[model samples]
Target: MTDHKEAITILGKTIHLGESKELSFEVAKLHTFNSVEVPVFIERAKKPGPTILLTAGIHGDEVNGVEIVRQIIEKGINKPKRGTIICIPVLNVFGFINLSREFPDGRDLNRVFPGTLKGSLASRVAYKLIQEIVQEVDFVMDFHTGGSGRFNAPQIRIIKGSKTLDQLATKFGAPFVLYSKNLNKSFRNTCHKLGKPILLFEGGKSFHIDNNVTIHGVNGIKRVLHSLGMLATKFKISTPKTDCVFINESKWIRAKYSGMFKATTPIGSFVTKGDFIGNITDPYGKFNHFVKADNTGYIINVNELPIVYQGDALFHISKELL
Candidate 1:
């Protein structure tokens, strides 16, 4: 639904048609009574159209996600042609400030969606987001990266079997389209429950910014907005160099021995059965294990950690394709 009316209210501020405003959502104060706010950027075109929300940095350490959204705002790509564009680059400001993946209370913001006002600090922030922000948008594109120590290939993740989501993911044109179910209590799940269409973009790793990852993310955003007829005229949308591989099922390749590890095979590369993907060896060089692929598939995520114990996940390989 398009907000074609006079003005839209957000965070207690009334923003009229075609107005650009920077609003802040204040949730807490620091120990010294310093107020913290999560900045929200809004851009609206005079013409009536759909509103799309671009968000990232749910985990404070996911700087890659924050950078992707920042570039969108800095380059003026968020200036829409016929609708509204909302950007919230850093959602977990507290965790971001502390350089952590969770709130000061040790709660992961991503796991507390549609939070309660009187719950933990993370829950309060989540509640504020869903109440003051998410409800105002028609569509959403949330950016993310692999967990610490794992570098993910550029991919668009959505639940399988929704033709609308399928079409949107195709338009996004990332290197991979992963069919992942929404996690319980996650923001994706909360938004889906509210009937909002969301496309989760994952790339790079936490606290690391890769040029390739940022490029893919920005380009994918452009393409998706272009498909929605929301991208501005000055912006150019290009076809993705390769057709995104649609993965229906996947599994992780774990370490067999506790030791130093390194991956010889690059991420996003296809490997057949028994291919030399990586190796594990003791620091004293007393043992060496050359890890091999268990089946034919593409490598979507590679654990970049230098040391791993036995059974630690190393590579995420595709198993079934659509």
Candidate 2:
């Protein structure tokens, strides 16, 4: 006999989430526009445990997270040994199509969460997702990356003061755990309000895939699943060595002059205030603008490309005070 179809009731319609197969559901129905539904499922292992929601591709340009999820599900690392794993690989298809960060309506889906039923396209998607998935999950792991020309260290961001979330994040064993205060309109904040602990992993950059980062992300997710007892695997994930510091202060060092950029400091390097981070030189190598750090801190992210415009953010620094 065929396995019983794992299913969820949405819009009064029973959507089948085949026990061990990838499934897609239409989030929006457009006649002239080609759009598909959101994909969700329960990778149950015939045991009982906590439910974990894995989301990626909320920003279309940050495609690395989507690829990370795909690799995990397709490679069998996401095979749950207990509870369920709900994986949404692409949350913004329109943004993904043109390799952009926002939806077709130019809205950042991550910034508009717990959205409205009768709102804009982004709001509608957020509404359906919240109703159909978020409300049903025990824990959430949202994936993200630096959007368009920015790069981030492979790190996990947990809401400040959430001991449970922080503990869970440290267990995931990512290289760094950043204490991020919840913004008013972010997906993490919405989930926090709903009492669901969500961990956000950020790395790579838009339009680029770092193979090592993808692997690290997948492994981290699996480790979190294991820690929650949703997987039977006994992978020993590490706890943070020091108290994860709160990244309460951060600033983007912008290019004062537009020219060809040459980065002098690399990501992960510590810099003092007023130190040169990079240089912007003209095509003929005559005029040059020196970019300097405004604060003393560890560089968490930097733009690798050798190009810049006035006001372009070249480096991101999180205050070391914690």
Highest TM-score among the candidates is held by which one? 1
RMSD of each: 1.1, 4.3
Please give each candidate's TM-score. Answer: 0.98, 0.87
* lDDT measured at residue 76 in model 1 versus the true structure, 0 to 100: 98
Off by over 4 Å in 1: 1-3
Cα error, residue 292 of model 2, in Å, equals 3.2
Query: Mind giving the per-residue lDDT tens digits that candidate 2 earns over 1-322?
Result: 0223355443345434424545575667677797566666447666555667888989988889999988877776666766667788888987887998998888999888889989988998888788877776678888999865788978888866767976787677776677767887788889999888898999888899999789779778877776766655654444444444346567788888888988888776779999988888999967977788999987878887777888888898887555
Model 1, 1-322: lDDT tens digits are 4556567777878877789999988969889999898889999888878889999999988999999999999999999997889999999888778778999888999999889989999999999899988888889999999996899999999998789899999999999999999999999999999999999999999889999999999999999889888899999998999998999999999998999999999999999989999999998978999999998999999999999999999999999998
Clashes of each: 0, 3
True-vs-predicted CA distance for residue 154, candidate 2, Å: 1.3
Candidate 2 overall lDDT versus native: 0.77
| Candidate with maximal lDDT | 1
